[model samples]
Target: MPIGPQPHGRRGTVEEPYTPLNLRLVLAAFGLVVCVGLSILLFRMGWTVPGWLLAGWAVVALVDIVVIQFRRRARARAEGGDHSLFE
Candidate 1:
């Protein structure tokens, strides 16, 4: 049996709320810190390959943080509010 309401010719659409950007930014920042720290530890322990891999992931996390900051700033500007890093 079909669950819930059918498509019904696409007359009605449901919209889902999105995760807040600040939360995403915080998570990305945390990931970057952890990756960098672990990669450094791995390098000190002579695990070069894994260290490099973690370093690469750290870079990705840094990039995500930058993008999220930009988006957050834009959103704040659109909403006519002053946006700060700690906000």
Candidate 2:
């Protein structure tokens, strides 16, 4: 089906802009990079309390981001496309 461009204005009661799936993907990528960079920095600082904490944070962040991204993509596919951010 041919989908047309969606208007980029607030449509709901809450004031906000429409964030497309592609833009979300880009943000997710940046988040992942930040997680990785932090993890590397922690590891480079040698094994310590803060290092362990950062490592745990990195794991949680990576998992959360990956799961969210996959769910979004899957939901988009299951429906018709990325027309709705609702999952």
Candidate 3:
């Protein structure tokens, strides 16, 4: 479906606006903070921490990359053509 309001023949509320890329960047940064916070909590508790912290960091990084990829794919699809060359 198109990303905006529906066609005139059919009506409902307008679609939600596309969020700015800065918002995604901020969310990614927040994810980093969460990973760090988890690591610190583990450390404070005197548990074996680095191993699990590293694992958590890796998962967050993977998720960040996935979010970026999802944005790229959605933008490309919205443009409706092979726009890779522009990249």
State each model's C-alpha RMSD to the native.
9.6, 7.6, 7.9
Give a tens-digit lDDT track for model 1, residues 1-87: 211222323433355333366778888999999999999999999999999999999999999887777766666555656544444
In order of listing, the candidates' clash counts read 0, 0, 0
Candidate 1 vs 2: which has more TM-score: 1
TM-score of 2: 0.48
Candidate 3 C-alpha lDDT tens digits along 1-87: 333322334423456434443356566667777776777777777775684865588587668756765765666565544433223
**Worst lDDT 10-window in candidate 3:** 2-11
In the predicted model 1, the residue pairs found to clash are none
Top candidate (lDDT): 1
* CA displacement after TM-score superposition, residue 4 of candidate 2 (Å): 24
Question: By TM-score, how accurate is candidate 1?
Answer: 0.73
Q: Which should have the higher lDDT, number 1 or number 3?
A: 1
Local accuracy by lDDT, each model? 0.73, 0.57, 0.57
Badly placed stretches (over 4 Å) of model 3 are 1-47, 80-87
lDDT value, candidate 1, whole model: 0.73
* Model 2, span 6-83: residue lDDT tens: 333434344533345455656666766776677677778775666667667667766756665664555456555445
